[model samples]
Target: MDATESTPILLREDLPGGIARLTLNAPGSLNALSDAMLAALAAEFGRLAGAPETRVVILRGAGRAFCAGHDLREMQAARAAPDGGRAAFADLFARCAAVMQAIPALPQPVIAEVHGIATAAGCQLVASCDMALAAGDARFGVNGVNIGLFCSTPMVALTRVVPRKAAFEMLTTGSFIDADRAAGLGLINRAVAPGRLEAETLALARQVADKLSGAVRIGKRLFYDQAQMGLAAAYDHAGAAMVENMLWRDTDEGICAFLEKRAPDWPR
Candidate 1:
């Protein structure tokens, strides 16, 4: 099926080697995360969680800007509702947060292929991913504070990936950092020329996809699980995961292949 044609708010393409690219499809609004857009993304992530064929996911935007954040017009319209938009705003943020959390929960790794500007909730989306690769000209910020709406939701993911002081500074100042600066702050893995952004992101995705899927799944789960634990507990959990991984047939084959000086014949 043509995934891109199947959805008006989001585009999906299954590339070679089990890499799935999901592009935010609203280019005219700079790919703002409208309510429909968030719903589409959440649904796609739900499907991919069970899709065994999908080994990695690449998230990109369709327009000049990666994402400019929430649809202000939509949000403003909600204010006319009887409850003064409180319930609507609550639901919107809750759904958006679930979608962000879903990225790391998926079995496959997710890479944010970012270019142009990624601000507010857009920046939150980038931080939610397992990895991010941005074009050299890209910019990132969680600048909701500038408009009187502090980026509380984005802060959850941003502070986890970036240092406390740096994250605090960005949150308070509503200032943007260039791609290179984002990389330095651990928000992205690397920044490359705009022309090479897709190629570089694909290469990185392919590298992860080349690994044994079961092992990768286990590792990905453990990586996040251990992060929230104490050092001793983290080690204990990771040790068990390592033991389980070593028991897999693929692990044995890989070890034997290494000793024999040949590539492992992994199952396709």
Candidate 2:
């Protein structure tokens, strides 16, 4: 697909190495999640959910920044509403939550390939991914407080991904952390040199691709399920997952290949 010719919100394409890339394409505003952009993202993420060749997925910005958050100008207009009609803002927030949830719910892992500044909703995108890798010195934060607006949707992922105080600090202060610090705070998976960001990310993406496809999909699904359960329920849930996986044909094929001293052909 000529992703460049697609809507100025998001673009999708199959890259080599069984990877899919979803580029946030509103370069003029650091790829901020406009309403149209968020809607497009939901659709493309749905497509990736069913793609057999999509072993892993990457989310990145087109130009200078990953995403600056929801379009503040939209908020400004909402705030300027006559007679305090700001319910539109709630709709906007809900849509942002849906878009963010879609990332983590993907059957295959999603990687945030952040390069430049990622603030507010952009930083939430980083927190919501299965893994986040950034170019060294890249900046990130839920920088809404400084503007007297709250990063509500961002807080959901941020609180889940980072420690409590650390997550709140970013929200309360709206200050940015450099890549290394972001990783240390558990917001980013790792930091690589800017020149080598794509190579490093693709290498990691390829590593994900080399795994059994069915296991990756099923395992990722179960992983999320288990995360939300109580500790005792988690064991019971994993037990069910184990039973389900044990009967799968891939397991039988995997064991057979192991005994035969050859790599098994994993089925998707």
Count of steric clashes across candidates, in order? 0, 0
Worst 10 residues of 2 by lDDT: 1-10
**How big is the positional error of residue 208 in model 1, measured in Å on the Cα after superposition?**
0.7
Judged by whole-model lDDT over C-alpha atoms, candidate 1 comes out at: 0.93
Mark the regions of model 1 whose C-alpha exceeds 4 Å error after superposition: 1-7
Q: After superposition, how far is residue 177 of candidate 2 from its true place, in Å?
A: 0.9
Please write out the lDDT profile of model 2 over residues 1-268, one tens digit for every residue. Answer: 2124445568777887789988888888788788778888988988887878789998888888888888877767776777454688878888888888888788889999999999988888889999989999799988888989788878989999899998888889888889999999898889999999988988888899888888888888888899999999999989998898889888888989999999988853
- Model 1 TM-score is 0.97
Deviating ranges (above 4 Å) for candidate 2: 1-7, 83-85
TM-score for each prediction?
0.97, 0.93
lDDT of each: 0.93, 0.85
C-alpha displacement of 4 in model 1, angstroms? 12
TM-score of predicted structure 2: 0.93
